[model samples]
Target chain A: MTHQDVVAQLIKLVEPYAEGRVAHITANTGLTGELALDSLKVMDLITDVEDHYEISVPLNTLADIKTVGDLASLIQKHVGNDA
Target chain B: MKENPRLLAVRAVRQELATLGIDPFGIQIDEILSPTEGLIQGRRTILAGTNNYLGLTFDPDCIAAARDALESAGTGTTGSRMANGSYAAHRELELDLARFYGKRDAIVFSTGYQANLGMISALAGPGDTVMIDADSHASIYDGCNLSGANTIRFRHNDPNDLAKRMGRLGAEASHALIVVEGVYSMLGDRAPLREFVEVKKAFGATLLVDEAHSMGVLGEKGRGLCEEMGVLGDIDYVVGTFSKSLGNTGGFCVGDSDEMEVLRYASRPYVFTASLPPATIAATRTALRKLAAADDLRLRIRENAARLHAGLAALGFRLGAPANAVVAVLAGEKVEALRFWHHLLKQGVYVNVMVPPATPGNESLLRCSVSAAHTPEQVDAICAAFASWPGARV
Candidate 1:
């Protein structure tokens, strides 16, 4: 999947947990600031994204991700890679 | 002039507590009346937050043992175990703990926090990986940080996530150390130890179960979740504290592996810190003996836990997990939780007011720990206090 496609999928996955904040979710939206997602919520979002894409997002990968765009790009990179 | 970071942090915390209208930190109980009751703020309060699970803090035998040791052995050890410490009582307690868990070796530490810090850091080094639960206690996180290993957190209580993370480690999976708690301290939920054992075995990862909350509260002989789940032998390390069920202050790590003994020499936290006082070791030894045979105390605490959990749930309070000794009542907002906690205190009941990011899920919790010493009437009074709180029911 393309990075933009992954971002769209991420927004949908995080919407229910974000408490109607999906309207503000975009590629540049900060996961913690704009969406007010805590570490646990971020983990939940990661789980949902992983299950939907059938890929494992290593926890270490989350360290460098700050915005929806960063997460989307990471997910895109891992989508089909066996690692 | 640039603002001092320390002062800035203190002022920020003070402002936050001022806004909440309650100071829940470092509450001083003017008098501890019993194992389960105390005088707080000049009012008699039911002590529901003290993690005295077996209620042996005031047990006659334990107190007597402590007194005798204090009288005979003097006060402090004055040095680390690697130095002038390692009194006879300390080694005896280690032997007792090792025998209690049916493990070959046990290493005692100054506190439970140090136990995790020492064990985890000593086990996994720069070349290794440590996989822990997302909801693990701060000590575990600090331990992982100290390990210098590439740390990864799997979703809490999810073995599939753990397995996947281990799989992602590729050839390094065998060097991974999987850490989880027998009973989580905050939410009072248990790890699926059986499933975790399977994952550990499949990945060839070493398993460490911190039984700080479960020790003397679960299993036939109260060895903790590993024993209760019938997978005691599979657990590579069993870490626990004496502060909870044993009613003292110290920690231990017991395992059958020969490498466990090397931690005594290699673990910095253990080598550098003063050993537990002679009195604490004596009292813990006494408590451990009682814990091995105190089935009645275990039953009472469990019964009390069930009563409090059921009563609170019936009153429309959101619970964090199941009806365990550590029953966490969820208050979605920090301000509301502070109000609920203050109201309960006013009603002669005391519980922990936990706020994020200290609590999991950024949730606020009125964490209640049940004890065997609490009477059924006292449990009802605690329940009634929660029931009467306007914010809690909502």
Candidate 2:
């Protein structure tokens, strides 16, 4: 899958968690800042992403995931990778 | 444009405690009358927030052992065990710990935090994964940071979540190191260890259980949840602390794995840190023997735990966890938790104010760690104090 396809899916998964702020989300939308997602909420979103893609996002990678684009890119890397 | 994250984090907690007019971080205790009583701010207070589960801190035998070692072993070890600090007593403690757990080997660290830090970092490396509980202690997280391993968190105490995450790893799960706690220190909940054991076996992963809170408090002989659940033989490593039930200072990792001996040379935390003081080692040795036979002390603490849990539940306060040695009353908002903590201190009942980051969720906790030394009267007093709070139900 292309990065755009991954971003499109992530936006849908992150929408419900972002609450009413979903309307303002975009590729550059910051997960922690504008959306104010706490650590628990971030984990929930990551779980959803992992489940949706059947991927394992390493915990170390979480530090670099600041925006929707960053996460979409991460998901894209593991989209079709094998064991 | 980069704001210091440290300052930002401090502001979040400081502003809340600032409103309460007290920090409660380092309140000096004028005197320690017993394991359950202390003088805080010149007021006689019931210390319900200590980790002295067996209440042997003031036991004459343990104290005498410490005093004897203080004279003979000359206070501190003065260097790291890898250097000049591995005394005969240190080796004896390791053997005692190994025999107690029925493990082939045991390695001691200067503190419980280092035990987790040393083992997790040494066992799992680059290209491997470490699956840990979502609510594990900071030491576990720090260890994962140093490991250069792919660290992932499963839902706290949820083995199914762990299985799902590990399954996603495909063949990578085989090299994963899973870390969990015996009794979670925050909410006082025990891990679903049996289910976790099944996950460990099915995935062919390494499992480490930190019995920091449950040691000397669970099982027939207080070997922790592993013994309590009949999974002691399945776990790869068992890490624990001497500060809690042992009423001393230090940490240890016991296992039958050959990697433990290799880790003995590789763990930087073990190689660089000063060894635990002689008094602490001597006191802990005495306490370990007492822990093995003190079924009465365990029963008393369990009863005390049940009383506190039941009393708070009856008060209509939102309880954080089930009956355990740690009874956490959910005070909710940060400001409110600080108020409740401050009020308890003023009422001569001192409990811990556990706030965010360390706590599992946003709900702040008035955490009470029950001690075997606490009298029935003291437990009643603790319950009464909660009832007296104006916002007890809120």
Candidate 3:
């Protein structure tokens, strides 16, 4: 699947955890911003993402991630590598 | 207004806790009367928060050994184990731990944190995958990060969830490292070791159980939860801390794996850090022997755990898990938990106030660690303190 496709699906996953503050979750939506997710909620989101794609994301990768697009790109890489 | 998300988050949580005008983390025990009693603030308090399960801290044998070692061995080791610090006692303790578990070999680290970091990083590198429980300690998470491995967190204490995650790894499952704790520190609940061992075997994976809280508290022999659960032999690696049950300092890792000794050279945490102090090593050795020989202490702790658990329950407070040693009274919300902690303190009872994200889920906990040192009256007195709180009905 394309990175854009992953981003679209990720938007759906990120919505419920956004605390109703973000009306739209674009590819560039800041995870620490619009999502308003605390550290614990971010972890919950990561767990959901892993379950959805059945791919493991390295904990180190979170250091480089800030936006939904960055996460989608990383998730896409994991998906491709696992495939 | 800070741009740092981590700091901002902590600041927010701290503000909620700060409103109560008490810093639970900064509590100072003016004097320690025993393993179960201490002077906190100005009051003579029941020190329920200490993780002194075996209560060997003030044992005459332990104190005497430490004193003798201090006189003979000077103060510090002054070197790392890989360097000049592999004192005779360190290796002897390692051998003792290995023999205790019937493992082929063991490696002792500076602390339990380093034991996990050193072992996990050495076992799994860039190409490997690590499956850990979601509720694992911060040290375990740090180990995974340091390893730079593909880390997947399975549902806490759920073998089925782990199996699915391991299955998803495909070929990587064969060598994946699975980490779980025996008697998780937060709620004090134990892992289903048998079910986890079955999953490990099914996936052809390695299992590591950090029995930090369970050792010297569980099993008829005071080995750990792995022993109590009848799957001690199935675990590939067993790591634990002396700070808790041993009532001292330092950490250990015992395993029958062929590569156990090889990790000594490869692990940065082990190869670099200063060795444990001679006194701590000596005291722990004596404590270890005492823990092994005494079944009465273990039974005493279990009884105390049950009494406190039932006492708090009778007061209508919700407990996190069944009785065992750590009894967490779940006080929902950060503000409420903080208030409850102060209440306990005012009544001459002290428990570790746990808040998110340290605590699992959103439940704030008053974590009470039972000790063999506590008398039945002391345990009842602690429950009475909780019962005195008007919010006990929750």
Of candidate 2 chain B, the 10-residue stretch with the lowest lDDT total is B11-20
How many angstroms is residue B191 displaced in model 1 relative to the true structure, after the best TM-score fit? 1.7
**For residue B248, what is the lDDT in candidate 1?**
90
lDDT of the structure predicted as candidate 2: 0.90
Task: For candidate 1, write residues B115-134 as lDDT tens digits.
Answer: 99999989987767898998
What overall lDDT goes with each candidate model?
0.89, 0.90, 0.89
lDDT of 3: 0.89
Please name the candidate that would achieve the greatest DockQ relative to the true structure.
2
Model 1, DockQ value? 0.31
Per-candidate TM equals: 0.90, 0.95, 0.95
RMSD of 1: 2.8
Stretches of candidate 2 exceeding 4 Å from the true structure: A15-23, B1-5, B392-394
Question: What local lDDT does model 3 show for residue B213?
Answer: 93
Report the C-alpha displacement of residue B89, candidate 2, in angstroms. 0.6
The C-alpha RMSD of each candidate to the native structure, in angstroms, is: 2.8, 2.1, 2.1
Show model 3 residue runs off by greater than 4 Å.
Answer: A1-5, B1-18, B392-394
Model 1 misses residue B310 by how many Å? 2.5
| lDDT by residue (tens digit), candidate 2, B1-394 | 8878869967866775577688878678899999999999889999998898999999999999999999998978889989885999998999999999999999999999999999998898888899989899999999999988998888889999999999988888888999999999999999999999999999999999999999999999999989999999999999999999999889999999977778977898899999998889999999999999999999999999999989889889877778889999888887788888888988899999887656886678889999999999999999998888987466
